[model samples]
Target chain A: MSAPMDKPESSRRQFFNGTVRGAFLFLLGAATTLLFRRSQPKRTVWQIDPYKCICCTNCATKCVMHPSAVKCVQVYPMCGYCKLCTGYFEPEPISLDTGAENQLCPTGAIKRRQLEDPYYEYNIDEPLCIGCAKCVKGCVLFGNGSFFLQVRHDRCVNCDECAIAIACPSQAFQRVPADKPYLFKNREHQA
Target chain B: MRRMLRACLYLTLLSLPLVAAFGVERFPPPEFDAGYKMPVTTMPPARALWLSYVDVAVLVAALALASYLVLKKRSRDGVLALSVFSLLYFGFYQQGCVCSIGSVQDVALALFNSGYVVPLTTVAFFLLPLLFTLFFGRTFCSGVCPMGAMQDLVLLKPVKVPAWLEHALGTLPFVYLGAGILFAATGSLFIICEYDPFVALYRRTGSFGMLALGAAFLIVGIFVGRPYCRFLCPYGALLSLVSRFSKWGVTLSPTDCIHCQICDTACPYGAIADPMLKDPHPDPRKRARRRLALLALTALLVVLGGWLGERLSVPFSNSHATVSLAEQIAAEDAGKIKEPTDASKAFRQTGQPVEELYAEAHRVRGRFAVGSVLFGAFVGLVFGLTLISVSEPHERNVYDPDPADCVSCGRCYVYCPKEIVRVKRIQGKNVIPLTPVRGEQKG
Candidate 1:
């Protein structure tokens, strides 16, 4: 049955609800304004700082994305184009041939082609690259350090906290402006 | 002679500053006579910044529509349709990143770390739902939140959890929120986002453990409505607090209650409060005594919680990478461990003083000590308040939706005979009383 409540009591409850609602609204407004003022106007996306990367291979497995957004990038201008390209061939190979067993990249992402009698050009097959940083380690160690890893924005969902960042040994992952998502190795130091 | 020369070169390369050698060019590109053109490395464009704004716009529109459908239209069908759209757009399409649930960490990080600049979209994602909950109750939970919608869509044969069990389990979100904030503020982790069950499903790939967690929640959701929303979502804890003071909320019946108790069973979340027949404790003196006792118990709980939390600081501090790294390095130096972890090797390669790393770790642990104490105290306060409120007498006179627990999913609308009559009357159908009038039944 519909029980009749005293009008004053009902009105008092309404007044209390109204007062609380107003107070809550005021608090929310203050928080919103403060947060908005503190926030950056520009949006950010996760990127990898090429310089600080230690090629620990954490990016290959730790990313939330299956294949990871990270891929090895080749800087052609700084390439030595050596016949025994360290980045393309395993440390000790039977012969410097394009054999799967001798390839430095587990996924065979690095493609080696002869440019001249003594020079060879290495290209990265982005789709095949697992971001394991194998070739990057090789290049950095013995070659011209032309190979490095970068987060491909198209494949990246840009999680608020990048899983790979947490797993990174060298703390190389960072947030860069959405407008400039990728960090490239500069040629200034390469003479 | 060649092998010896190679050995000498290797030693020199190793001896050189390895960090500085990263971008060094020992050999230049070979000049080509065949006019070979170098293919430029292509950089993929990031997700458009305007798309993030569009997501915010969609969120606002969905929340507004959900509130209207829940409060004004009181249409369950409309709310369900909206929930499906939210599931697709926010859950599947956007892949559950930048969600309000995860945005809690972003806000915490931004507030504590001056270096962190939370994006405008993230702040909007964090605050908009709370603002709406203050005015319109948790309409966001009803049909707008993808996580809620994911669970809502999976619900089948719902089973009621025991009130005592529900109350105990309900405290988890607050504890989780505390840990999430503590870790995020300290720049340690985003535990909420890291442990998010549904995000793995949305992204279609994750660590096997995460995928299993998502699957478990979905399976559990089939029998228990919105398990994540009710017991695990930190954002829901915040929304529930705001919704307690909400101005307007979903009503069980459009007109008046018939005391049918149909809405009580209709609610999968058990959010409908039945009318009190009479006061449970009529004696005022006994009531005051019980209240005082409960208050004392609450105070004790708060102290115990805080003390326990402080004791946990050392273990909790290990969650921070630097602290764990420092410990690892110490263990290595002590010969307790032989192999250096990748992190330790990287740290050593930086040539930073071990003492500096130890000092940083100490500073972080100090922050965690303070943070854990506050976290424990906050959890204690929530538990104490919950106990006090549960014991408090209610003045409710009708089958009213509990403002804090009701998701405003509009499930109870059709169950109310009064609501059914109103719907039929609106359709211009010849109305027949579905049940005998309450007054006539006694006569």
Candidate 2:
């Protein structure tokens, strides 16, 4: 069979394609420049504003990663080092001791060591902490609010939209600079 | 045991609480006689900023390589190899965060919300594939998109879907795209990222429902080829639109068409377009009349669809958290619900005015009303165009790849006898007798 020739139509199609392609290229270029101009110079990562956080414990369950990246961090300067630390002990504890049952932390993450007479240092076992924020509630309400939840950079996969942030009722999540990922109670007080 | 002891010792050494005494100190820290050094609170460094630039570089390289493999080499093996690498790097290693598929929301949010700034990496991820597709049809889908790669690898037994069903299901991605953009624009939610099916599989940790959804897609993919790519991927929908005007794309045969009909069955996506012979007798008047009628119908559909979408605004706006919170608070006040939900209780604790919450929700609802109408009109336009295109007669006289649907997988190359002959000639092997064309006598 002889090849069907449509030279005029072919030329018209080529011109149309060229025009459309050029328009699309221009549109893409404009969009890219606009977005680039609006983009922040410093990359930001997900963080929890300690003051806004109501310690609802959603961080434990709502994180995409099991065990959650939101770990309870202790701001040492702000801590009172009270012997009867509310963050380490449950309400109406049987005894003011480091017993698993008396500890407010679900995973026994809080380790209480005697620093001196009537002063006990509470350290968080980062691996054992499940980010429940149960202790945060106790600390914020009953004692110095030294204990606060922070998204640990090492563990966080840093999802574009944090699952915990969506679930937070208080709208506590904020995008902090990557270099200063943690939002500490002490630092906020200092500022 | 020694490691545990060391850790405990390290914890003690790091636990020196200095009495800066900034906050309300209910209980004062005990003073120590010995000079005890205060250890600063340590923070793990964030993922290096430079690494994100590396991801962009890798993405650019992959897109370039994919276009070369699909067009220049026309090697299926090369495409498969590249796709596997994409699956490992983009899917598992990166854990599927900030992907092009999910970046749609970021771009939308950036455009609509001035407060929200999209990262540079995300913008690169969002725009690169479209730029590549505009020049060389959907090479991103062929080998670079991790989601497509995952589905492609799982496709073992390909089942051909009926044309009508395929066309019906094909509208889903457009709807999904519309909703995703709407939600993102309103700053309500990133539904696209929230419901991503493969992210859980990539991370190996997510909600049970997401895992189940991913599993279902994979199981369905075993029989169907790239189910998500064809029917659900919003990014794929965008790419297809751009691919229609691609400058260069995969070709079935190296030389002129010999009408072998082998490549017809070779493409799992059914992207091959068969030759169409011109009718011996034509009626130009009837064709013109039908086209005009269809155009009128399309215009009518756009109006009707927009009206229907306005009616749906109330239901769609409920998906926004603020609107739902307001409704919940209102319900509790009306004695519809005896107990307040956690969210409502939290709102009450904030001591914010109830009227303010309602006002915010009303604003959100108003935005949704406008957004939904536009979304519906777009959907209507796409459906009407599809109908018109389906009714039009094909004018092609040669077997070719459907530009919009062909993903440049390069699978059809091996099916062409002419391609095999070319390969053999390059290998310096004995030439086989050329197959005679149908209805033409061989010498």
Candidate 3:
């Protein structure tokens, strides 16, 4: 034998190792089953807390869908109702016309309607929106931060792991329960 | 043992009521106004209580099959089939979350975060394989692990890394495990799961950088043969350490070794040890004396490493979100940063006390300091062991698999002549005892 071939000592070590392994397994098994039982009703849906979003333009590219499910939503109460809406019009628009060149949304998802004289109401066309967050950034910077991104559940495949959540830079994506999924940035939202 | 089991049962029972009490609360009211017609809500499919149990059952079955194939059957083909199944179920079907590899972080996080209740699946994923490995010598690694399976499938051009280079590179897993625990314990991130290469492939979507990293690992695996498992998998490091004392293990042959060297080249992972009967070094007594001194030095290094780690904990603590936020708030206060980012803005709007945030950061940093000392000691211990194992080479009279390194892939069985004879004997064929042929005996 290369080393001491004490059978009793070797057997003792094996017994000790086996005991430790058994004890660990038993404890882990208990904890695991408890956790599983506890997690039964805990279903989570992917969502964005608009207040935490950094508008990094990742929502457009990182989403698995060709046209991202994330869409820009207008918080009407938070809107300043500006006639020269920074979100609807380009940064250096020649005029606030209905021309494509003057439109801020790359896909023309934001529709500018004159509610009254010197005030325009902007509504997001969800189907046309790519969630690039360009308008959200523009609005947040220059106007009342009314425009924000939210995951459109209608189009979402509900993947086990959200693609955009993994890529989100500011870690804005969260898993809120299915019942109250959207963390909308509204007038009531403190932040 | 009975007492322990009873205590565990009681504890689990006691915790159930608490779990139910804090169970899913009422969902908050709708964000939109009464006049606004909410879009039809598409909830994630209700996770049935039985579904999680099904996953657990599948996992248990797979482990059982893997152990059977590896230890009893010794069929590489069976192992491969299991690997393919694991790749399909665990990798593609489940999308690689709650994996044994990722569970390392969950366990670490739970240990540190007393309030954090680890998901049951995470605990199961972490332990079952380790338990199997302790008994059956890394049977889980052979085929059951989706990460290993993915890499195994891509092994096209196998190459033998130089022994010294392999030894040096093998140290990386320990460092990786230490860093993983450090990050998780500090609530910095689950870097292991975040960087898991095969997970992106399973999901069929992720950032370009992560996708590229996954592709790069697979490409490297074509030549390196489970390079991630050997050099980067923190879980693999844990398995390897525990597998050293495995009760049952793989053998190169069923019977005596004929000193044939074919099996030596068979193992892609370089787990086979080529025995040398003679002492390679002169002055055995002197070497023994030197070894004792080295052991003392290793002990010293462990203590010194812990001290150094404690000193460096502050910088390491920056990875934690609270610490980073605190530093950012301080920077903004000092007018060092011109503009506040979204996180800072959100924090300011929360109306939470800045002093409380600072205290939280301080507390996290203090924990990191303690965590770092343990991490440092672990690293130093690994370093000392590596040096000592190399210095005190064991005498081996026959070719054998190194228990610590062997993944039990069963590649060596086919190369062994005795194993071939045993197979023939089992199949009711005439078994011939080895007698040297005239030409072969000339040497």
How should the candidates be ordered by DockQ, best one leading? 1, 2, 3
Tell me how candidate 2 scores on lDDT. Answer: 0.82
In angstroms, what RMSD does candidate 2 have relative to the true structure? 6.7
Candidate order, TM-score descending: 1, 2, 3
lDDT tens string, model 2, A115-178? Answer: 7565677888899998999998777665577888999998898877677887788788988889
CA lDDT of every candidate: 0.85, 0.82, 0.75
lDDT of 1 at B97: 84
TM-score for chain A, prediction 3: 0.79
Q: What's model 1's lDDT at A37? A: 76
Candidate 2 DockQ, CA atoms? 0.38
What's the residue-level lDDT of B313 in candidate 3? 90
Worst 10 residues of 1 chain A by lDDT: A1-10
- Counting clashing residue pairs in each candidate, in order, gives 0, 0, 0
In Å, residue B167's CA in model 2 sits off its true spot by: 1.2
Q: Considering only chain A, what is the TM-score of each predicted structure?
A: 0.88, 0.83, 0.79
Q: Judged by lDDT, which candidate is best?
A: 1
The candidate that achieves the highest TM-score relative to the unseen native structure: 1
